[model samples]
Target: MNTYQHDWHTSEGYDGGLHHCRKCKRSHQGPRLEAHDCPVSDAEHHAVAWLGHAGLYRTRFDAVRNFEQSVTPVSVDELFELASKQILSQINEGCQRG
Candidate 1:
């Protein structure tokens, strides 16, 4: 796993504003000031990890067609769960086959 120091200001885009962290020489905006001026931990970065989980196909046309015809909603959570179950089932099937 790649590791980097929590440089919130640089990570958040260095804007010259009041919320900028002088120590880190960076800036923040909106409600970000309320939180600590450090990047979130890897384990806590669920959104990034969730992006890798496949769900709906590309294009709105395909998505609509799938939804209308196949009844497959583009739900990320559902897709992740389905993929996980398929993987586990495949592993179990392989074990049985062996």
Candidate 2:
């Protein structure tokens, strides 16, 4: 729920750490925190950035497909937008609480 943590891990391709932006969930490497420019200003941006990663896109697509089966189906973009808005809201709420 709390998405403030900038998740960092050792990169296999490099000696520095890889940082995952909490808002956009995009990975960054060899960049200082101050230099990293996260492009997640809204839900749409968050969805696009998050789904831009191949692994996350496939996994989220499967999950969204199942979700659609339980309710009215929507376009791929709309589905992702809805899901992204929900996630962004939760992150904001958690940030406020913390």
Candidate 3:
């Protein structure tokens, strides 16, 4: 497990405006940063970890771990679909209320 420290990254040499965070991949509007100046969400970290932990051809099938059977394998496209559904539903609800 790699622990991220604030001092590890800082954009000290370049003129800063908006730099995409290398850690979270979010566009952060701030001074040029060598280290990521944006806050990382637990969900984002977990997602990245899960994606990196699995490969395209390999799936986790270990049975010795706790709650292994409860895990479901989902593709990145599927995740986008789920988020799109949630967002559309919220938009619809807002539209109906007005």
Candidate 4:
């Protein structure tokens, strides 16, 4: 079920858009693409980098709490890794299909 887009947006994994940063704790502002809105540093353009982290943590936590009650639940870190892999795979698959 093409869960790539749903997973990424729902989990908030570095989609190259402004989000709620845990460090700076700012969302989007001013223009749409301008990094200056939440520009904390050249590397960290957004103030909401922690949003994805928080999302992944929550997603994984919920997965464990709901599905893996009888088994070992995936850790937050593991969820991030899984999201990354799934996204990359989806991108590559898209490229190939296109």
Most lDDT-accurate candidate: 2
**What clash pairs does model 3 have?**
9-34, 9-35, 10-34, 10-35, 11-33, 11-34, 16-32
Candidate 1, residue 22: how far the Cα is off, in Å: 37
Q: Where is model 3 more than 4 Å wrong at Cα?
A: 1-69
Question: Number of backbone collisions per candidate, in order?
Answer: 0, 0, 7, 3
Which lDDT tens digits does candidate 3 get at residues 40-96?
433434441122232222233342133243344455665677669889999999999
Candidate 4 overall Cα lDDT vs. reference? 0.42
lDDT of 2 by residue, 1-98 (tens): 22233434444445455666655666777753654354434443334322332223334356465453322224468667768998999999999999
Error of 2 at 77 (Å): 0.6
Off by over 4 Å in 1: 1-60, 63-68
Sorted on TM-score, best first, the list reads 1, 3, 4, 2
Candidates 3 and 4 compared by lDDT, better number: 3
The C-alpha local distance difference test score for the whole of candidate 1 amounts to 0.47
Q: Of 1 and 3, which scores higher on TM-score?
A: 1
What are the TM-scores, per candidate, against the unseen true structure? 0.33, 0.28, 0.31, 0.30
For candidate 3, report its TM-score: 0.31
lDDT on C-alpha atoms for all candidate structures = 0.47, 0.51, 0.47, 0.42
Q: Report the lDDT tens digits of candidate 4 across residue range 41-92.
A: 3222221122242343233345455544322235456557778998999999
Report how far residue 12 has shifted in candidate 3, in Å: 40
